[model samples]
Target: MRNPAFGHRADRTLPRYFYVLRNRDGEARLPVYWEPRPASRDPLVREVYRVRVAGRTLEAGNLHVLGDRLRDALGSLLATGQPPRFWLVNGACASPVYREGEAYVALTDGPRLWGKDLAELVGRYAHYLASCNGGRRAPVSVALFSPADLDVHWPELVWTGPGVWIPVFGVDGRLTAFGPRDRTWSVPAGPGAVLELWERVGNDLVACGLLQHPAALWGSEVSDSTRGALLASSEPTGLTLRFVHFHPSGAGRVTLPIRRLEGRVFASCGELSCLHVAPDPGTLREYLSAHLAQAGVVAGLQDVVLEEDGGASLHRLVRAERLPVGLASSHA
Candidate 1:
């Protein structure tokens, strides 16, 4: 009944470098670690406490910030008397992870949980992770999801990590994808708006039912109007845009390439080559401009447009600076 991970200890002895706070059931509710700053001149601060729940480093001189953060992270853990499903820690550096129903989703932006729908929430998390860590090989922070559906759909993509193949499986028996993941991409962020377009024409196929599943119109029951509307939806939308940094140094930039269109949340990722749906053309261009500028790749960017209807064809090319100056003028 008790989670052995927390251990059964009546006497709560503070460890050398880490502090463990247990709940009423004696389960480890919040375990925090820190390093002693002996040589520091400040008398008020003797050690830098590590809060490892958000997958980022937070060196606190005091416990106020640490307590506030831990309180939220430990809220559901205390009630359920279960340890975090997934924890990525490097010594005292750790981040908060929350268990949401069947999905053990991790939030990198902050402690608050956003999105009511499960798929949309996952979509947002995927969007955030890809934008931030798309260009880099080693990810500073990682979020997890239920690999049940992912494995059934994409099995070969699992366990493609670095050289050291230490098996780290998710809640399910096996994980869908885990590794230093990278998207197979042809378009590079250059000086111009590289609009890569794909038109769904000729025996146009429209996906129906749940957004997660990839079911076609052949068997799935759907109205003629719904199928027609989806087919007629103009332009290839950008679901996710990943801006790989030119120089792989310094702190990485976390981009959020998530948009809500027609009452649905659309997320984009360059790594996952195929998807059931995408955003409109206008929105995709808008996202690209912001994506390049934020990643600081606009100076040398060549705006390229590719239409993938009758095969991937180069539509046009324009220098990013030469484009009409409007919302993106400042960045150019």
Candidate 2:
């Protein structure tokens, strides 16, 4: 059966706003938010979408207008400071939200979708509507940045006009993180999210082949026993990367190592964190087996020693596995 939310058969029209666009499956879904023509508008000539909120109903031509009304109704409380965070045609949100550096921007679209293994926040429609209009929803999503996480990682919230932007990388030399934004983090970020940034730094360094050289490990010359010993040590030999997937909530993040790797670069992934998270951290024979098993990636381990002091650590990565593709982020 056709979903009526798309619209009535005679005058089928769909809502294009963010919230209405995503269905229960968290896939692309269109709902009949409002129609082009009026069935019985309090107005005789213009068409309007009748929106219901907190037992109150409103009529407007589109979500933009509807959002404006919501802003006025819930003044002084928009995470977005200037105006409502409501948007149309993927345009910039009208509000001037928080400050990241010198820029002030609104929330725009968030808690955005992430990998398929991630699930949507579970909550009532009322809370969703309230939060969308004004950041009033609680317990909806896992904290992106917990207080403990924040102490370890500093956030770089940048404003790019309509919405706020998050920076994913910092300059050390030549490596650039594959992407700048966390697609999943478009929503209200938790303090824990800062960890994601650290992990990305590691992932990118490995991707660029900067930290791929084994020589970076045991010295100018690579030693067989050294390689075997380093790989064999299980006691936090080095920081490792991990992509944790929650069961139902459509939220996911890149977690970082706590000890010394907090805000460091991936060239230092081994020196800071352990290499346990690296895929091919095994010895010669074991590595060859892993490399052959996963032809998609060149599985290998490399140690990087970069600190004011002469400290080093082990690192490894499954190459070519971009976050979105490797994580299967393209579905419900």
Best candidate according to lDDT: 1
Q: Model 2 off-target regions past 4 Å?
A: 1-46, 50-278, 281-332
Question: Tens-digit lDDT track for model 2 on 1-332?
Answer: 13434534544344433233222234322232556565656564356655443223556776667767654543543334322211111122222123243222233345332221111111232244466768664322211211111101111321111112123221221111122232322222333233343244434434655344221221111123322343333233243333322223342332222122223222112221222222233322233223222332222222111112222333332212223435544221
Superposition TM-score, candidate 2 onto the true structure: 0.21
- Model 1 is weakest, by summed lDDT over 10 consecutive residues, at 193-202
lDDT by residue for model 1 (131-167), tens: 5566433323233422121111112111111121111
Off by over 4 Å in 1: 1-31, 62-65, 72-142, 145-332
Task: State model 1's lDDT.
Answer: 0.32
Give me candidate 1's TM-score against the actual structure: 0.26
Candidate 1 residue 167 Cα shift, in angstroms, is: 14
By summed lDDT, which 10 consecutive residues of candidate 2 come out lowest?
Answer: 145-154
The top-ranked prediction according to TM-score is 1
